[model samples]
Target chain A: MTETVSRCPVAHDQLPQPAPLPFVSEDPFHPPQRLGELRAEFPVSRLLYPGGEIGWLVTKYADVRALLADPVTFSSRNRQRANPIREMPEDFKEQPPKPGLFINEDPPDHGFYRKQLTGQFTVKRMKALEPRIEQIVADQLEYMAAKGPVADLVADFALPVPSLVICELLGVDYAERGSFQEWTATLLNLNSTAQQVRAAVDELDQFMLRLVKQKRAEPDDAMVSGLIEAQDGAERPLTDEEIAGIAFLLLIAGHETTANMLGLGTLTLLHHPEQLARLKADPSLVDTAVEELLRFNSIIRVGQLRVTTREVEIGGQLIPAGSSVVASNLAANRDPEKFDNPDELDITRGAVHHIAFGHGVHQCLGQQLARIEMRIGYRRLFERFPDLALAIPLADVKWRTDMAIYGLHELPVTW
Target chain B: MRVELERDRCCGAGMCVLYAPEVFDQDEEDGLVLLKIAEPPDSSLDAVRTAAGTCPNSVISIAG
Candidate 1:
């Protein structure tokens, strides 16, 4: 504590302001070059958050992993309370989301809900889903071939494939995808107005609530239905609100993150034709390629928000208790200490250790599904159209820098 | 190589299965690591090592 006080002097305000936590890059495929330097120089730096608060910005690979793994010292529960960019209005009277969202919870509660869905996302389960996913990929490619010479890959393929798959898995109607996609887009956009975000969230919740009610009355083979059935059979059944919360999380997380990955991953491959050619020549590289793509892009730019629950020492710096901390996945994935030639994207690199899906207890549950989708999606897209290339110049492509999930807004491609 | 897993510590990140599917599987109930072959052949030793190293929970260990 004495050391911590000495390092962070009483006149903190008078000291030079540290670089802001969220590093906005003009190039969405690559994070700001300064982040690498920061990771090397100041792995744990005091920084200003968008909400006008100072917090710890952790950039090094080992440090980021350490903080993420120790949820006891750094709690995800602070995400709602100490969000740098507050999403809700100060006077908004709606009750905060119940502790049912597993990602936001800590310890026993997180494990309780997460374990319930773990079996559903196992490698075997995802492997079983691979064939159906392949058909979905094939169908999308077939449609693209029929409509092409030119197409916006994001809308025509990237977004819909996952949307449809998730819809089928969740038992949500595929026809409702357009509205939900819009809602998700708005809800995740960093630049979106609070009112716009709230409206989108309300719409999504209402739809999920209806679906939960429907599932309660009549269960089916989908994940949501399975959850409902589990709830009914349990000694202490989950409330409809809890069930709806789970469904809502799955619906958005199930599609949004993967959709962005597909769009951005394709764009990244297109930028490096040599890599694309190598992948096209050897389809078996799909698995490793997906891992590399995930690592190279590391789409969730700023990583997850956490607050130190107790005084923690990281990268030789003391992060005071209750301080907001951001572990940059973008930085960690590119850590020179972790990977060789970190900036270069080599599909054959086999970067299995990367923290793209994140690390520790709250790692992405849908990761296996996302990997299979990418594997099938990339393989089928390249296989079907051997001459696939971008329809528009790389400069013209719109990057979703304003969104929480980093990716291309529209990737126009031509065969 | 003989592979071992501390099932209780498994958080189901699935890196082991992804890297060395031939040597590992996950429980259908909770996604915990399940060793398919306790002593995999020489050909799979490299993959087994990768799986052990990549596991976030460090649940997997290997010894001859």
Candidate 2:
């Protein structure tokens, strides 16, 4: 029942015995309860992939960090397209990752593409954009204020803030945000059929192709034009298709993750009134609050999936070569070993060590930008609407269970 | 404590800068690790150690 070449003779026998990956969480704010139980009794256990493959599940905080820290032992290739929670389309199996999809690439290829954009997302660079991000946040707050005594924060403020920021950063027209959001939502939906995913990918590709061509013809101050300008000096410049792929990734990644965070984060604050009161009492808590919020609500519910390239021991379990492994980011963040009162919301926890942005070479490229957005978004939000309250009861709030990224479908709120 | 850096291996994840901004910075042009202090004071050791441990590329090394 196991593929691991166990160092301990009884390790295979001790396996929680190949249960399916836990994707559903009973409580919207926390990871799946089964995952927490496994973290307690069996930090490293076997999981059944949707494709009928047995993989290792690493749930301990320390183990998850170690697993992600070493790229050599564990590869991100996903060559089998072995998703832990869902079966992938047959066409995706055994296919080389598309160019500019460096997230799946290892070594030199990943570095080559990552280096091109790293400068743009550096701590200082992202910090420089703080005032602009603050302006964007304030403008959204104003828009929401104009539209409400009642408003869906998801639609009015949370979604548009990151969407506008990312759109401006990429030089894409914000007017076309509706289509981009739809395409990306389709792409990110875990239940999206292969045909729907293909259609979304095709539409996004066509849109990016046109945008890249437009940037090439006329340079601008944004990232796309910057890429085109850099190409001239690059030894092996990326092709137009590669550029389009990169743009497509950034567009989807930039907006969706943060948009979900904003919507869900507001809801989280509303649920934890004491924490919210603490933040309002001391607005400076925004910095640590954002980090704590990130830790508490680890939005990437699917976890970071990797495949072992060689026989390796993680948390005393010997995982065999060529086996899929999932590092449960959500569980890791909530580990009692790493965090004090792991399940509670404490904004002052200063939870910077959480792997919400992940770790290692593929650690989120726009984390600094995301941080800046969240800091400003949450601070200005509470400051502006001092009497903000939820329009619906906490139990009635709809959680986004369909998408790979966990968040709220809509946060109905009023001042 | 003394620190050594292999800048080329830096993935520019900025974990180092985030942890030890006083001792590390990212180059403006490429975002590679730029060590500001080769031998930082003992007061900065914890932050530096955390930075080294969390660096995605494992490019930072510490020596006594």
**Model 1, A1-415: lDDT tens per residue?**
5765566422344434665755677566688877777788677777776556788788889988888888888887656554554444564424454535778888867777887788888988889998899889888988888998798898989998899899999999998888888899898888888798789988988888899899878889999888887775677677777778888888899998899989999989988999999999899999899999999999888677888888878876767788888888899999999999999999999898899988877888889899889999998888888888898877888888777888988988998
Q: Tell me the DockQ of each model, to 2 decimals.
A: 0.62, 0.70
Per-model TM-score, in order, reads 0.93, 0.96
Where is model 1 chain A poorest over a 10-residue stretch in terms of lDDT?
A7-16
Q: Which residue pairs in candidate 2 have backbone atoms (N, alpha carbon, C) closer than 3 angstroms, thus clashing?
A: none
**Window of ten residues with lowest summed lDDT in model 2 chain A:** A1-10
Residue B3, model 1, lDDT:
89
Model 2 Cα displacement at B19 (Å)? 3.6
On TM-score, the candidate that comes out on top is: 2
Error of 2 at A265 (Å): 1.2
Candidate 1 segments whose C-alpha is farther than 4 A from its true place? A1-16, A84-88, A91-95, B38-43
